[model samples]
Target chain A: MANYLKLYPIPEDYRFHRGGQISQGLLAYETWGTLNEDQSNALLILTGLSADSHAARHGEHDTAGWWDYMIGPGKAIDTDQWFVICASSLGSCKGSTGPCSPNPKTGQPYRFDFPDLCLEDIANTSVLLCQSLGIEQLQAVIGPSMGGMSALALILNHKNYTRHLVHIASGMASPPFSTAIRSLQREAILKDENFNQGYYSATNWPEEGMKFARKIGMLSYRSAKEWNDRFPRSLKKVPQHPFGIEFPVESYLEHHANQFIHKFDPISYLYLSRAMDWFNGHQYGTPRGANPLNDISLHSALVVGAETDLLFPVDLQRELHHLLLDSGVDSELIVTDSIQGHDAFLVDQQTFSQLVGDYLSASAV
Target chain B: MANYLKLYPIPEDYRFHRGGQISQGLLAYETWGTLNEDQSNALLILTGLSADSHAARHGEHDTAGWWDYMIGPGKAIDTDQWFVICASSLGSCKGSTGPCSPNPKTGQPYRFDFPDLCLEDIANTSVLLCQSLGIEQLQAVIGPSMGGMSALALILNHKNYTRHLVHIASGMASPPFSTAIRSLQREAILKDENFNQGYYSATNWPEEGMKFARKIGMLSYRSAKEWNDRFPRSLKKVPQHPFGIEFPVESYLEHHANQFIHKFDPISYLYLSRAMDWFNGHQYGTPRGANPLNDISLHSALVVGAETDLLFPVDLQRELHHLLLDSGVDSELIVTDSIQGHDAFLVDQQTFSQLVGDYLSASAV
Candidate 1:
């Protein structure tokens, strides 16, 4: 299993405006494959909501990232050929400096007092992670969903570091659907009696609230047609469970909610979900004043979307692709015909693998 | 204002396998305009989730149904020539027998004790209302979303009553997306501390749960792209809002949630959402087994879908139309381009009105 080691006192002053502030922090990350001597064969992957740095093959038994389908050796990302690194994002719970982490000043969970994070904070932390690993340039920075947002931020904010950017099922900024979903999730947490206005004790946590939040998210991650086809009102002869959720679809959601409650931290889920809602291209300064895309020179950019992805639809991906093309950047837009919805980038391995493999191979030259 | 003289009681003999029993009840509904002496100029309008018999005309002001655009004097249903009757379903809050209604025997709210209601219950109640009103038959039965399901049920269960069926942004039964979304809404209600396992006190009811439930419904009711287009990370001028929700979309949801909490009954919302999840054609003893269309006998059927409807997509509606045609039934399908999404049936009146007018006029001869 991958282990964690924390470096004391980050030298950089961390600035935030969401009430609580952290002067310094450490990052927890994991790596796969091996770095080449030239350090040019490196790829940094970003994670979506409720994900970790376990990008690929964290354990001897072949434990990989949430997107293990696209990141393994001989897989789409082909870790055997290129070194891959992933880090738990800021404001996330997976061994990262987040709301559940001990506050540097108080030595207690930051709780609601944790500073609100933007895509910039996530990109800044990833930059530090790259520096800590002694890597000056990344061959490609790739991410899906919120990770996609972070990847865009990385390329736009630190143009010199990321040569190629691959953002799948994401947007240039936080869209209304993302914000609406996040708002509901946050409200679910805030309204929980045990939440105590984000000050709940460790023992009596808001498990139900977290479950509800996950259920809400599960709806957005998949498409309606897929659900209609997968679990069409056929009453499976399985005896009615005690949960009153008799349908296969209901059972699926229940299972997902239960799994999320067990694996995810309630506070961290809230903070990260909110972080995704806060992502905006305008945060780098007004687009009216500065041409951020014009400033960033990318060797190549690949934007991929799933046909049924209701969260970041193909239209939004097209918007991003058009923006890159308008900026005179080399870019290719591909829409994956998958019913897996927004999670298609992770679930539809064969299609996603082809896209990623082709993009990586083309960008490498 | 429409008022009922006597509230019908659920019969005590009825029993449900889901550990609850629904009392058999009757609904009193009224109509506007004149029913031609031939009784062929009557239109039956079904209500959406949490809607009431007040489908149109709130007062003598001649207000229209929730679908004012398609149900007015010169519009689709053509109230100028057709008598329109909108009835509240049996298990509803607005002057209908529901979980919130007092049990005749126990003299207390039914709570979880309310019997599980299938689509048949709504159709059955509507049939009885039609019979009491002395309408021999309906020229057309129309509804949107859940109302669409009810309309389908009316045609399938009461074949001879309705000559034409118009279902918009809905299908024969509840799809997995509906089940998943409804389950989340149910979870929201169940997780509320004040819910008291559906026996919540009348004073401090589960308002937060209702808000959360409404928010979940709202997400499915609109398209993700529409949300992005309408509320693109543009910060609202409102100063009191926090970071993650500083966008207009967040504010829109907050306002929507608050409105839902104030106007909608929490227990009723849970009941309706659950009923929608439990809707299955197989449960109703339909002769065609899993496929309700095989047994449906209608003079004509018109199915409409909103281009951006995420909950009930155009493809689903198309499938239903195909099924109707495959079953040798006369059917027409139309896709309305509307940013309002699933709620487009209520919002995009002009387009839908024209479609309905053309279809109804063609069927009249």
Candidate 2:
């Protein structure tokens, strides 16, 4: 790992896709391996809802990235061969410019006042970051879930500049069912008295509501079959709870929900979640049943889906594969045999590695 | 239609299985058709979480019940042949005594002070109600979802006293996955600021929390396939809300959630939901791998399940069917073919009525 963990400050004139421009915004990113002589080996990696730039552990920041397993040396996106630059979403709270960040004009946290963000903004900003990094006309891009949406947006804008594309567990837009779930999650957060309409005090956060929202998100992330398999229909030895959460599965969700409060920003969650819901491939003028990457000089692309995924179901992935092939884009689709569902990209690392490893390392970029 | 929407009060000293004792308690009920000269054709119908005694129209109230489609004169239960009586579950707010009712001694609402309830209590209370109605035996018992659990409990205790059983979209106990979902619903209710430790004013209900919980429940009641088929991924033409909900599905859920607040009771939801989680078939001492209805003269049992139901997956229903057959009970398990899922029993009235009508009308008390 060379000139790692860096920030690219975006100037004010570089306005947002929607209204309310950020005078001074920044993108947090971490790069692993050398950027090769021509910089063509650099792979831009994007993340899911709350994932960070730290795609893998490096030096003192010892904390691992959300996609830790996939980006390590000798792993799927081998650091020894490909220069990896994993950038956290522009509106995420993980060191990126977001709701919790200070407003340049007011010098106060933007909170709900933060500029409206969309998927395209994140994708476009990352491309600009690549340009700033002096990486000319370069490498492959890998994204999962929201990251996949951003990858599509990136290729749609910078068509010929990008090569290979790997989109996993995402689609043309957030489906109606998923959008409904997200809206309910936002409702939960908004109903919390402490949420204070997205201006809850940093100290007295809407922890309860945020935790509940995370729990709801967890249901969509994994499938019912996985939960049934992991947690049996038996009571915990501890005497029954007066609150009625004596089952192992309930306990598991509570534990995870608790952990989520400290790490996730409620306002950022609202912004990013809304950003994902607002995204649609048609916004880029891509016609229905038409491939978004057809005009690109992309070498080969891989569209991955989890068979049990309820969020971005496998059917959408199959559609994407067919669309890509019809567009004259060299592409392969892999429906991973996984019960982890939409989260297969994170949980079923082995299958993802098996399906995507050869392709990322196939020397296209 | 005969006597309708009557309340039967229970004297003090009546104790519950979990804890505490309710002194002045009541069970609300409604009946249809004649009980016959011998009182031998009296039928008892139990209910799910939020169901009321108005299982079908009877007198002054005139409004139909949740299962109205299958409970009229020539419907599935056939009021012309058998006297039909549907009683509200003990912990429900529709009519029965619950947490919202005042404490007999304190003159204040029971709130959290209300005694913990279990599924067996609902079963036992209905039996007592039958006895009060001067009926020596129940000709038949029809139960759906949680009502099905109570039905199993009822047969386990009454043995030969009850003649037939029709259980739909339910099982011996709440599965781990369903339990987990219910637990989350409870968490949402508890997390609500206005829940006020379950002491929110009757007029100022914990509307927000209850509505959010209902939205979560609506997800489990139906399958993803049904949602997809019902709500397409098309965007609403009103430009787009800056805050994101631009889909018609969002509008549908928001509308339903708003309606839910006016009807469902938050405290009743919490207490009754726990009642379901606490219920296990083994509590009645039915040996493992042994059918709880075996020791009785159950003429036949029709176990119906939905093909797409996610809450009570069809697998459990299959197991119950096999167990009934093994125990020598003349059981006919009819798995309903529908995309409506757990709510299929409520929505797919034609299919349920067809499967149950033939069996209920085939014999007599």
Candidate 3:
């Protein structure tokens, strides 16, 4: 398949949200459809932690993207009706300048030397990418999961950037439970002997730690109902070893873990995962205790969540919906009865497409 | 504090439910109140996975036990009116013959050489202890969490052993979600380098693995609501390292994990945890495809579960209650609003005490 990724250079001495700066940075992005004459049809798409710029197929020669089913000619976030732009988040390894990217100073990967990353930084960089493309205002900005936090960051920080917002499966702040789980995931990597204080090489990669972290992620990503329906006490095979994969669920987790460990950079994963925990959109409020998202100026906002999502439960979305209303923004909340949990937005194509498509179509009027 | 523990040895040939036999087996136990001349007042207390025989204090000189709030005189179990006996489970390391015990055959810790232990084995061993104590029949058998499985095993296998049962925070079988969590916990221990195939020495103990496992356990034991109320996004301190404990929740988990890692035997944990997953009460059915508990001649059974329990959820208990009713047994299910989750039986003193106390008092008639 053809490579649809396009890199946009960040201007010199770009500052990070937390601290530090990169002299030279790049953001990989892709666009579908065309910018309108007035540049008002641009719909920016912010992504979850591990997603790339490829939201869907650009052409027959291009590979299918993560959100392939939700974005296309007649699909939700329809590219034909609106110019859609998806950027690989800042600090991600997916063709974006990150810990895995070569440091200009030493000609080596930044690794731990990379500045602390935050969702705010991810939002800011996407704004930069949009400006570079000569788009001043977007018709809508859609985000899901980690991207949902980044979308909130964008709207909270750059109030006039988008006329509408579509938030999916995220909370304004990471609850204590979510924070604890992410902290444990980070611990897995840090405790890995092969991690070597973030100096791990290609050969000495912390494969076990990455695999463990991904398994933990998989556990939280979906609901128990889904697993029960998929593999309740069904052993794929008799376990030969004491700690081996006994249940089909174990094998399912092992399969995903193995597939994920080698695909993502460990340090990048650590940074992005921590960024989610540190995110508190309420911090953007003018007064110390005010709801930060209360005053956002938007024509409309659509919040969607899964009934079974353990990570980003529906109550969080309900809170977000009320916050938007309290902030004087027109907002609506849609809860899907999808058993896939936090990951339902990604895999519950039919439900999400219907929700997003209906909202966007109505908003365009 | 007084030593409330009493050890009793198994007869010449003690066979495990799954397979294997031990020539010398030992059980540790503690009791409160007096046994009636006819043993009609005997009340056996089966424990959760990690509990010992000391369910409550024996006297002022004895150390306060895990269930001190629930098992004392005038408390939930009401020792004043019942001869209450609680025993360290057969596969546990609390003063019992377990993986940590010296094998009579090899004169060394059994470790991986220990036979596969099941909840049924734990049930059978508890029966032996009761029989040895000259208690031919019991007024009631109360079990919570892992003990609930053992309690079910007892009723299913030894139908006439007890007149009443109080099942708390467990199910007839481990649901796929609960199994997945436990399977991951075992993986953490097995992967620890210092685990050394269950031959880990005192100095080279798999502390990291055990700590990780316990942290995972703590995550499932309690409710997210409790964590949010207790810790929220409150940080204990500014982290000095990238992955240090920053959130109060992290430190809370760290405190519990550190305390647990050293106290519990890793192999014993592995064996007992797997037993919960492998437990299938239906296997005891006399005819194929019948309710295993259909013929149990119990006077009454009480099933209790927490609404917020992520591990052994209330639905499981509800299912068990329905199954018991279907089996011709008089049973009731009580769902508590306590936010402590699966660990509510241990910590929600007021709620559990009221429930257990009221039921036992009613059952005495």
Candidate 4:
């Protein structure tokens, strides 16, 4: 595979949001289009829980990025008019420093020794990367799912850092339902014998645990309606064993889970998932006796939610829009009738691209 | 604990619906009130997947039954006016002949050697129990959740077995989304090292797998709205370990899972859950070139569903009602606004009791 990923080394002794410091820290990213003379066209794209920095392809030989359909030169993000930068989250395995990364002092994987990761840390590091790139101010910041939480952290931590915000399928903080599902996913991994307290080797990896966790994640990420329409209750084949797959839906989940078990690092997944549960947006303004989103200083904002999003239900996005307006920011909320759930933004390109494309065009300064 | 459970023995070798024979078969059940002279006032109550035959308390020392609130004298079921019989399904562990039972021929637990138990078998055994009790006719048959599916099987297979039907929170067949969730749950247990291919000993039971499966089951049994109301985004305590319970919801799931792990047999759960996935009501009617429900001789039927039910959504019940009406049976559909989800019929007594009581009273012959 041709490498399109770029890395930025942070200055020594970088601090994290929760506590502690890392001797070595790095952020993996990719950029497209041109940084204008005044650097005002810069737009930062943050991603969901498992996404990496490769948001889109840069060359014909490059493997397709996670969001390649929506981020190219003439796509929804439109690199022709905007200098877009997409960064892998700090506590991730996609060419970034995480639990899987080696500790400079010990010459061993940080594993649980890595400091507590927060969406705040991801927001902070991405901002530092922006500064290092000589971009003093951002024209806009686009965040979807977990990335939306990081975007909130970015603007709240550094007021007026961006002019516009595009928040999709995310909330101010995690809800109890999502929290329960995530907790179970983590338990599946930690209880695996092969996990061995984070000392799992390549040959004896926690494959079963990771596959189970990913299956649970897939259940929450997509909508019931989509599955009903796609797989129905049709039998795939006669089951010879008691617990074997019989329905097409079960087979679909197995395929997806097997593909994901080895692609992502288990320890990193644990850290990032916990970070989402710990985030409380109310802390941002509770001390001031107001809504937590009271300080986001964007000139305008566009919030997008889907009717079928079970993980981050559309109501959370509605709440986000309400808070943004109360905080005195010009905000618009769009609730699409997409049937693909929280993952609709990734695959429902026609609807999402037009919605996002129109909003960016209208927000041009 | 005092045993309020009663048992009935099958005469000799009994054939199963899916091609197997049991040398010894027994059904555990409980009854309230008395059978009338003609047995026309006898009513049969079927239960969900995990429930036993103890629908309510018969004595002061007897433990409260799973549906004690709505099954006693002057309650919704009004046992004073009707004799009510509730039977544990044949493939269950609650005092019923199941995989946990010893095979009469080999003096060993049937385990995987047991026949493939279907809802049809449950319906057949319950009907035989009714016959042994000298009941020629029934006033009504009430089934909730899995019991509702068995009720359909009973009326479809026996034809005119009951004069009226009350079905709650069930469907004609399991939907794809539910099949996916149930498949993952079974995988959780089957993947447990301690499970040991159904030969798991008491000392080395698949406790972790069972607990995990129960947690997933709980997620589907209840509604997100109820969880949001009961356990909000409040932190229970600061998580000391990475995967420890951090949110109130996570703690709630853990508590419930621990209480359920050893209460039910894991192998029985696997069989009952798979039976639900394999059922197709259409199969009954396809051979005759008509609706499967066309043979059901009920004078009236009441179908109850909750808007919040994720496992068996309201739409399924609506389809059931439509099918019953199309098959020439008088039917009414009630979509309750209760936030209790699929388990609402067990907990939301006020709504369910009134709905059922009204139907039975009107249909009294």
Going through the candidates in order, their DockQ values are: 0.62, 0.48, 0.70, 0.75
Model 3 / residue A103 / CA error / Å: 0.4
What does the interface RMSD come to for each candidate? 2.6, 2.0, 1.3, 1.1
Sorted by TM-score (best first), the order is: 3, 4, 1, 2
lDDT of each: 0.75, 0.81, 0.88, 0.88
- For residues B261-282, write the lDDT of model 2, one tens digit per residue: 8687788888899889878875
Which lDDT tens digits does candidate 1 get at residues B86-156? 86777677777777888877889887677766666777667767766688888889888888887777776
Per-residue lDDT tens digits of candidate 4, residues B21-123?
7876889999999998889899998889999988899866778899988888898888889999998889899888999788988898888999999999898
Local accuracy of candidate 3 as per-residue lDDT tens digits, B30-91: 98999988889999999999999988888877788999999877787888889998989988
* Pairs of residues clashing in candidate 4: none
Q: Locate the minimum summed-lDDT window of 10 residues in model 1 chain A.
A: A2-11
Give the residue spans of candidate 4 off by over 4 A.
A1-3, B1-3, B287-290
TM for chain B in all models? 0.89, 0.94, 0.97, 0.97
In candidate 3, residue B117 scores what lDDT? 92
Candidate 2 Cα errors over 4 Å, as ranges: A1-3, A59-61, A134-139, A237-245, A282-299, A361-365, B1-3, B11-14, B36-42, B59-61, B134-137, B237-246, B282-297, B361-365
* Candidate 3 lDDT, A1-365, residue by residue in tens: 23667889987677888889886899999999989899988999999988999889987677889999999898888888999999988899888899888999999999889999999999999999999989999999999999998999999889989999999999798888888788888888888889888898889999999989888777789998887788855346778887577877888888989999888888999999989988888777778778787667898999999988888878789989998999888999998899999999889988999999999999889
DockQ for model 3 equals: 0.70
Model 3 misplacement above 4 A: B286-288
Please state the CAPRI-style docking class of candidate 3: medium
The candidates, ranked best first by DockQ, are 4, 3, 1, 2
Error of 1 at A213 (Å): 1.1
How would the docking of model 1 be graded? medium
